[model samples]
Structures are given as structure tokens and as C-alpha cells.
Target: MKSESLWFIFINASLINNFVLAYFLGICPFLGVSAKMETATKMGGAVTFVMLISSMCAYGIHALLVAVNAPFLQLISYIVVIASTVQLVEMFIKKISPTLFRALGIFLPLITTNCAILGLALFQTNKGYGFIESFVYALGAGAGFTLALVLIAGLREQLEFAEVPNTVKGTALTLLIAGILSLTFMGFSGLGS
Candidate 1:
């Protein structure tokens, strides 16, 4: 059971069920904050931190909900918890690591409304992932999200020097690139199946 759950979490989070592609949760940051590699890396770290903490909190709260048989409140409960946690994390980062915090500070509030973080919590509960499983799943999903954002940032940075067409300048080109990247991720679908 342990081994199976571990494998399931890793594969699901990493490839077969990417948070960005399969779930379309964090498209906001995936597009907005990915302009520069430096900012992208900071955003990724902040997100990963939030994800890991939220996964643990979500799993514990989910267990409580299961005990009470009040699964209907899962969504609200998860959001409340994640939002509060993100706020606390943001403050801590601002005080402790101002430089790092500034880099990610602007993006911190954004994650509060980021569907990806909430989706991760809800999905873990809905799927009945154990504690360890949830943690690993969150880690994998964070890694995948970071990978996608960084890759896009790198591409966009290079495109800065290139002669992009007028029609496909700002968002059109980025979305098109994202579509191509999504197609690239599709190639990994068969790995865990």
C-alpha cells in the first residue's frame, strides 16, 4: 500500500496529471511571472514552500473532515487554511529574508488566489492520499510547475532577442509557446500508465 501510493503520487504529480496542463490551475503565474528567469525561480521556490505546507495541513484537515463525515465543507476549509498559511509565510519571508521575499513578495499574494494550490489540497483529499503520499505529491507537483515556468521563462528570454512577429508579440506568442509545451508534456503521458 505504501509503495503503491508513493508511486502513484510521484507519477501523477510529475507527468500524467500535471497541475498546469491537466488541471489548468496555475495559469496565472505560469504566464504572468514567467517573464524573467530570476523572478520565475523565486516564484517557484515560494510556491513550492506553500505547496508542501498546504499539503500537510490539507491532509490533516481532511482526516478531520472524514471523521466527521462533512466532506462538503472541504473546499471552503482548504481555502481558508491555505490562505492564512500563505499570509503567515509571506510575513515571515519579508522579515527573515527580505531580498528573497521581495523577489517573491509580489507573487505571494497572487498565490492566495492561485487555483493550483487549492486544487492540490482538494485533489489530495478527494483521492484519499495518505500523509506521506500527499507530501510527495505536492513536492512533485511543485517541481513540475517550477519546471514548466522556468522553461517558459528561458524561452521568453531568448525570444526577447529574436524578431517576433507583430501579430504574435505579447500574449499570443506566449500562449502559443505554452500550447507547444503542453504538447511536449503530453509525450510523458505513457510513462506512468
Candidate 2:
């Protein structure tokens, strides 16, 4: 039964309902950090990595909350745990791979503030997902995020060569493109229904 629920959560998190296009979470990065293809890809990978870690940590914390009968602390605890974990991951990345650190440094800390990461943690608790379920959900969500970011970045890179209007030069163009992408994702609304 629990195994079935985990599969359901993973599928829901990935394709049926994605964090960006479906839930509209993490739009800041979606629009702001998606200018350059290389940077955007790096940012997506960094976010996915953080999301998985944060999800696992949040699940463990949720278990502790259930044990202590203080589920009310779930929100605060999850945020703290996610932030700290991002920090640790940032440091480890810096130490392990200086090139990756340089590519992802600016975006690494930003993941701490990304609403999607926090939202994933909160939603996992709200949905009462267990350890494996939460892990799979996080992985699926991260993949969804990466897919969205990479696709948008690729489009934006192509748009660079196109003759976009001056009024929609930078942010305006990106937002318009994102709006279109969101509509495209709407086609997947019935994917797992």
C-alpha cells in the first residue's frame, strides 16, 4: 500500500503536476536565472541536488515531529533543516569541485530561498509521505524542475538570435516565453489522471 502511494507521489511530482508549470513554485529562478543556457543548466542541476537532500532531511524531521507529537513545528523545522543542508552541500561542492562551485556558487545559496524547495518539504509533510515516498517525490520534483529550466534556457538561447522587440528585450521576453511554456505544460494536466 505504502509502496503504491510512493509511486503515485513520484509520478505526480514529476510529470502529472510539476513544481514550476503546475504549482507555479520557483518562478523567480525560472525567469531570473534562465537567461544563459549554460548557467541555467548548472542552476537546474544544483537545484535538483538540493531538492533531493532537502526532501530527505525534511522527511526525517517529519518523522521526528510525529514521534514528538509536535507536528506544528513541521514548517519551521523543515525550513531550518533545508537551509542548513543547502549550506553544507554548498561547502562540500566548493571543496570537492572548484569548477562546479564557481559555476553554481551564486545559485547554490539562492536555493535556500527558493520557494519550491521549501514548498516540496512542506507538501511532503502535509501529504504524510514516508521515507521512500518522500525521497522519490523529491527526485521526481527535482527532475521536473530541471526539465523546465533546461527547456526554457534552450528557448531563451535561441531567442537571443531572433529579433525580439525592444519593449520585451530582457525580462519581458523571458516572462512571455515562460507564460507560453506554462501553457504548453497545461497539456500535461491530464497525464496521470
Q: TM-score for all predictions? A: 0.92, 0.90
Candidate 1 vs. true structure, TM-score: 0.92
lDDT of model 1, residue 179: 89
Residue pairs with colliding backbones in model 1 are none
Whole-model lDDT for model 1 versus the true structure? 0.86
What ranges in model 2 sit over 4 Å off? 1-7
Supply candidate 1's per-residue lDDT for 78. Answer: 91
Clashes of each: 0, 0
Tens digits of lDDT, candidate 2, 48-158: 888888889888887788899997898888889888888888888888888878866567787888999999988877887878888898998988888889889999889
Error of 2 at 70 (Å): 2.1
